[model samples]
Target: MQIYKNLLLKNQTQSFIDDKKHEKIVVSNIQSRKNPEDKEDFSKLALANYLDEDTGFNPLGITAYKMNYFLPFAYSFGSLGNDNRKMEMKFQLSIKKRLFENLFGLNEKYYIGYTQTSWWQNYKHSSPFRETNYQPEFFVDFPLENHSFFNNLRLGILHESNGKGDENLESRSWNRIYASTAIFYERFLFVPRIWYRIPEKRKDDDNPDIRHYLGNFDLNLGYLGKDYFANIMLRNNLNLRRNKGAIQVDIGYDIFNNGIYWYLQYFNGYGESLIDYNRKLQRLSTGFLISY
Candidate 1:
């Protein structure tokens, strides 16, 4: 009788442990279903890793360089010319790869980045692409330590162009050398950048006065929250009499508590695209952002 009682007690304890384990597994699965990317920080994860861990050294790890989003319904508020439509689709793809890290023992990292943005007139009659801007850049990032205000600095040279021939008078392109810094305070981020446009030949210049519209400096301010984020970009040419620039606002919400966000963007002013560098307009767009 004593042996039977002991055996029964042990069995009950084992059963209780099993039940707890099963409950934990079920809860984990439910949480995973709710937020699939919770275990991995999807927003910061590199989009591609060509080398495996066993390789020990990865020289070609590619990551998202800027906001990668697809805006299916971007509607302009004002006039957009006779042939262009008011509503269209827009998308951007940006990526970067680290070339060297701390090569000079200064903790400076070098990288190459490429970004492409396209404005598609999908709602138009023949669904022609309005404009596509391609930007390729090389930069060095220096991380600061014990800095009270600024945390990082970057210096880069960038070239952006609309893939258009000069024959039709539709060519637009620019080259710039820029310096930017990053400041962080709690959940807020501030980035200020200044750039100098490289000179082009008289015959090659498509937009000579582009600097007046796009400005020499720009400010980016962002607020990050647990389930939402917002960013405001401001640019000013700083002309005393004929001040001109642009403003863009972007807000994103994680409605399902997932990594993917529903994004809204508002832009007013010039330089929305290479072709529209000198044209001022207002646009409101809704989209989805996989990485920010």
Candidate 2:
């Protein structure tokens, strides 16, 4: 009888140990599920690894140069009865290289990047390039997965200019010191940015009153999901009486778990391009977007 009692106690002890192990496994699984939703630590992840990462430098420059067709087909209106009113196309090409990682004891990465966006009047007789905006930027990314709402911070200087002839009366250009922040809320991401135009010589100021139209700040909202994504941008002049602003909406569906997506974009407002900074436009376009 004593032997039987000892055997029963041993069995009970083993059963208790197995139950504790199972509970620990369940807890670990819960944490794994929450990590992706909560921990957006960009410092460790290469730029190409993070899904729905904001527009910025890829630290490793894994994809050194990339060209994406932003809007291959679109009908634009509100040209104010201009001759070039018709179907148009737009595309962008960008390149990035890492300058330094963990710069000077600070946990940050420095990068140099150049991006060019072109608007094409494909239906025109000469197939003229309506406008091409060239942007060169030097920036630093500080990755912090802090307890606060802000997840990342970036500081940058950018020069944007339309490579247009000085003879063109509608010439536009600007230089700015910009700051961007990435905020995460479960599955939603918001990047609110602000910029101050670097003062140019009075003689070189192409658009002196641009602030009245383009404003000093903009907001970007994004949703990073499993199979689909959506992003929206808002900018305004903050003048309540003369309220002027712009809105851009982009939606995409992941194709076959690859980085390529079926993308649709829509814009309604002013400042779609440097040359058209003052022209109010309503454009709807569809194309493919490839993002790493």
Off by over 4 Å in 2: 1-67, 80-82
lDDT of each: 0.83, 0.76
- What are the per-residue Cα lDDT tens digits for candidate 2 across 207-280? 98788789999998877666577789999999999888999998877564445668888899988888778878
Off by over 4 Å in 1: 1-60
Strongest candidate by TM-score: 1
For model 2 the local lDDT of residue 240 reads: 99
Clashing pairs in 2: none
Candidate 2 lDDT (Cα, 0 to 1): 0.76
| Lowest lDDT 10-residue stretch of candidate 1 | 46-55
Residue pairs with backbone atoms closer than 3 Å in model 1 (clashes): none
Tell me the deviation in Å of residue 270 in model 2. 1.1
